[model samples]
Target: MDLSLSTRTEGERTVVVVGGEIDVYTAPKLREQLIDLVSSGQYHLVVDMEGVEFLDSTGLGVLVGGLKRVRAHEGSLRLVCTQERILKIFRITGLTKVFPIHASVEEAVAATD
Candidate 1:
């Protein structure tokens, strides 16, 4: 399936609303978006994946790369995802410790760590 991504500023954080599948083909789009946001100095990011239908290893890599980018600038990258399937991927990969996952965009934006 195709991937969709839209970004918006929420207070001090930028929220990237994502929908559809994020596999090898579509992961690059997400990687580019995250790179653009960080390059433009919007480091504090929240990737809202509630609309995400599927996520593969490549997508997880993109997220990890985004996290690394933000962290390099002393910024943060959090995730807004409540899907058990998606969450399971993180848990299984032990990425739940690497990234802070929230249930909502608001919670992610308000988080301080």
Candidate 2:
């Protein structure tokens, strides 16, 4: 399936609502969006993945890259994903330690410090 990405502001965070599948073909779209957001000076990001139907290693890499981009500006990249299937990828890759995953956008946004 195709990927869908939308961005909005909540408090001090820019919430990127992601839906559909994130595979090799679609991961780059996400990566570009993240880069644009960060380059535009919006660093505190909360990626809401509740609508994600599937995720692959490329998607994980994009997330990690985004995290790094934000961190370079002393910013943060948080995730909102409660899907067990998608969460398993992070767990398996030990990214659970690298990123803060939240159950909801509200929780993720509030988690920004």
Candidate 3:
């Protein structure tokens, strides 16, 4: 499936809502968006992944890379993921400790503040 990314700013945070499968092919799109946001000086980024139906290792790597970039700039990266399978992957990889995973976008936005 084709990947789509939508950006929105909530207060001081930039939220990127990602939809569709996030695999080797579509991971680059997400990486590009993250880089754009970081380069634009928007350090506080929240990735809303509720619309994502599938995620692979490449997708996870993109997220980890984004987190590192944000931290390097003294910013933060949060994730909004409601998918059980995805959550399991994060938990297994110990990314749940690395990233603040929220149940909804509202929660993530609130945490950013």
Candidate 4:
């Protein structure tokens, strides 16, 4: 699983662009990175997943976990998922209700406001 993260700060929000497969092996790394960002007091997080090719339960867990953490801090988390397969996972797991899904990174970032 290859992962690359790029962060763009806008106001009080931070959009983290994620590119690569998000699986059990790589989910922890993503979780850690997100946790670090949240702990740093950057609560509004947008995960850009346009480049992600795969995701498993671990990846979903990471996103859910981050959502919980952000909510606890009175912050928010949004996702940009365009892949049908990945979108299906969220739908099947009923996570579509838990997260605000965006068509693109720009939309996700704008939603943070």
Candidate 5:
């Protein structure tokens, strides 16, 4: 499954809409996008993962990296993961407690406020 990523502004926050599988091969794309966003001073991010089908350890790592990147700059990184499979992965890995997971992009974007 190929990964597709699109980013846009939602008020003051940036929303990254992701689709398809997020494995080792596709995780780098996500990582680079996050890096680009953070590097350019766009720290408030909402990763809308509802369209994501499969997520692996590498994907989780990228999310964690993004979280750290934003936190280091006193910025915020939130996730919109309504899928049970993806939510389960975060819960099992104890990441649900680390990342702010929301039901929708609007909610996630509002959370930064």
Candidate 6:
């Protein structure tokens, strides 16, 4: 699937709904959107990845960079990922310890520091 992204504010959190593959080719798009949001002073992001069909190392790098950027501003970045395949990548790479992953967007948005 082709990459797609849409953002909406939910209370104080920005929900970014992502669809399609996130690989070397599409990772830059995700990275740019994230940088724009953070640079614009809109942090508290919840990335809903339910529609994501595939994610590669490049995508993981982008997410890690996003986390660093948010942390620099004392902000937070959460994720919503229900796919076992995707979740397994996080586990294998030890990113499960780095990010707060929820099964639903609502749950991820509700999580607080």
TM-score for each predicted model, relative to the true structure: 0.98, 0.98, 0.96, 0.93, 0.97, 0.98
lDDT of candidate 6 over 1-113, digit per residue (tens): 77999999999999999999999999999999999999999879999999999999899999999999999999999999999999999999999999999989889878876
lDDT, candidate 3, 68-112, per-residue tens = 999989999999998999899899888899999999988999983
- lDDT for model 6 comes to 0.95
lDDT for each residue of candidate 5 in 1-113, tens digit (9 for 90 to 100): 79999999998899999999999999999999999999899989999999999999999999999999999988889999889988999999999999989999978877744
Give the winner by TM-score: 4 or 5: 5
Off by over 4 Å in 4: none
User: Candidate 5: where is the Cα deviation over 4 Å?
Assistant: none
Better of 2 and 5 by TM-score: 2
Which RMSD does model 5 reach against the true structure?
Answer: 0.9
Q: Please, what is the whole-model Cα lDDT of each candidate in the order they appear?
A: 0.95, 0.95, 0.93, 0.88, 0.93, 0.95
lDDT of 5 at 46: 93
Candidate 4 structure, TM-score to reference? 0.93
Compose the digit string of candidate 1's lDDT tens values, residues 46-112. Answer: 9999999999899999999999999999999999999999999999999999999998988898898
Report how far residue 92 has shifted in candidate 1, in Å: 0.5
Location of the lowest summed lDDT over 10 successive residues in candidate 2: 104-113
